[model samples]
Target: MTNFDQLHRFIFNQANVRGEIARLDDSLQHIVHSYEYPVQIQQLLSEMAAATCLLAAILKFKGEIGLQIQGQGALKYAVVNATDDHTLRGVARWDEDLPSLPESFAELMEKGVLVITITPEDGERYQGMVALDKPTLAECIEGYFAQSEQLATKVILRTDLSEPERAKAAGVLLQVMPTKASNTDVAQDTGFEHLCKLTETLSSEELFSLPVEDILYRLYHQEEVEMFEPATIQFACTCSRTRSAEALRNVDKAELLQIVEEEGAVKMNCQYCHTEYRFDSIDVEAIHAGRFEDTATKTQ
Candidate 1:
């Protein structure tokens, strides 16, 4: 019984460390239901989605974070996006006949690169790339943090795909806060290590089942923890007919009309939500003429 689709943030008052815990149920189900992915693929995407939410919670800005895996093996690519408001959507592309899911990350995503992109609503976008040479996605993410931000980070992600109707994903992240001149290195290191040891004891079953407060109490009851109000996470797709029409406007007019003539309409499907938007010749004409509102009125 997991209370899913929630993100909790907590700070250790005794140490210069902050943590986030996130669990996804309905959001996970919505993503998996969008595609008929294998169990392994679904689990992987679930973990990524959970991780994205956790990372998004840690950000201090107003924007979205995207996590992507590009591989040369059976898993071609996987992407998860989480907005500052906690909306999530994700998709993965893979070879249909993946003989069997590879047991190790290296084998599953051979020669892959993990790319993290942050798009701020008011600032310049940032991107970081890391080689996926680690045994687990969590370790890869930790490595990225260490390399890009010079911060020691630990991440644990778990996914349960046994129940089709109750697919679950959960993850926890802990990071060392930047040290000040007054802060002692030895003290920070000891605090970080102790927190990591406590977090390492978390089992997937416990993580998938326990409430956020209970989980925190179980792990850090000895420490002074300040729990913040939890945030709701949902499966939200940023797709719209207007966006589809804008995409159509990008095509050459001749090519766009040619497709409409052949197929009777230009059909666009959102990969994230599987919603289809169709535009007949008249709609295409309105889009080109910059009179999309008129087309909408006519259709109505």
Candidate 2:
């Protein structure tokens, strides 16, 4: 069987249209492992994961791309992040039991806005946000591209629940870039429209099942397409005890001691990975004494 957790890129040989597809099997499964999420949230995270992976693969940065949504309704927040290398992690929060399956995006995330953040390795981070007026996550991202970058971009995503504790997500992105190459009045417009029409034939099952070439051929048999090297995508978390310690160090010594005295230990839990880190009395005292080294990369 073909590996599903990979990102593939393709280009229309005779047109300015280019595209990317990402399939997430392993990464989605991993993100849902620790907690038992409802069907609707599970599917929601799967879609967010797929979209984040595809966006991460295309951005020209070395750090990470984060897709975050905040709501004033049932679901308080949802977030997914993927690095340039396709390492992804995500989580969500809600107050009570949500519907097993939401009928639409509005049902799950009411009055929500999508926040996109790009954090480069060695520069200031940039963030862009858009209101969620679209019906699907793909459409929301497409809206971002149109408003933020002014590119003609379309995103199509699919998620399937074929087995217990397993999920498959796939998506394709098509974008047209302005070029200086001359073309007949009708040629370039016709070519771009044709490519988009071909891309519309992609089925959800085919997106999750067939290999890349078969899917490409099924969509665009008349046009010559160039496929690029694939990038492997997987689930990864950046949480660590050192990072937690740094956060703890930001608190006042007196306040920290009071918490330690009352609770006997300072407990820090990573919201992303759900990993817990505890600092007992002695550990807190050490930090107060300024005896700890850098707490950022200790786990590394």
Candidate 3:
């Protein structure tokens, strides 16, 4: 049996800080399957998928978050979107193949920037951009949390590819509570530094494969951590024929008709779910009517 993908939250009994660790299985699989991506892109997708899921876990609102990595270099664009439900889908855009593997995050995204956008279902959206000069994706994310949210946070991500096509991506986040004061002199109250030190000692394999309790135990055996119920993470897309039809509504009617005349029909495909929605001449007329008749109705 496969271990269920889950996100776990824990807090130090004595410290005023909180932490989260998440393992993504279904979500990772869905992302990699969305396209026939190169091995390097797959690796990047795994890391970004984990990072996005972890970011969603720390939010106190209900919305979707998009984590994007972009540059003018060969790597151009790599992005992942995760929702409050831990459902995720991601894709990458790269043109030519590189001569060699990327040695570090900097090499992959030359002069890149990390763009984070939070879109709440009911409130105004927020966006933050951070320089991607860090050596690793984790470091860039930590930098974002520090500068954008002012939270002393650390993120560690790991992805493994082996036989049987086994792929695992996991991330851990430690953040000082917003209300906590940052001070160095108070040894007893210095939980933030202590937590960071403990988390830094974690290894990639342990983070990705081992159970959450075992990993936390190894990291904080010296201190007490109160663990909470885990939230499962999965690969799910919100795309639907209804939503696709709405997109069709936005396009200029004449433009859509021109394509339909040449191609015989209008086919809309969602990159996130790899699902195609086809609109024939009749369907286009209905779209212009501001209503879509159900496929069932057409068949009838």
| Candidate that scores best on TM-score | 1
lDDT string, candidate 1, 162-256, tens digits: 88767889999998877653234633654887899999999998898788789999999999999988899999987788888888888887887
TM-score of predicted model 1? 0.93
Alpha-carbon lDDT, every model: 0.86, 0.80, 0.78
Better of 2 and 3 by lDDT: 2
Tell me each candidate's TM-score. Answer: 0.93, 0.89, 0.90
What is the full ranking by lDDT, best candidate first? 1, 2, 3
**Candidate 3, residue 22: lDDT:** 79
lDDT of 3 at 240: 70
Q: State the weakest 10-residue window (summed lDDT) of model 3.
A: 179-188
- Candidate 3 wrong stretches, greater than 4 Å: 1-4, 97-101, 180-188, 293-300
Q: TM-score rank, highest first?
A: 1, 3, 2
- The best candidate in terms of lDDT: 1
Residue 171 in candidate 3, Cα distance off native in Å = 0.8
Residue 9 error, candidate 1, Å:
0.3
Taking all chains together, the TM-score of candidate 3 against the true structure is 0.90
Across residues 1-300, which tens digit of lDDT does each residue of candidate 3 receive? 134478888888787778888787666787875676667778888889988988887567888999999987768898898889777888888756766657466777778999999998999999999999788899999888778877777788888766326567778888776664542323236467777877889998677666778898999999889999888788777777677777788888888888889998788777776777777777777887887865631110
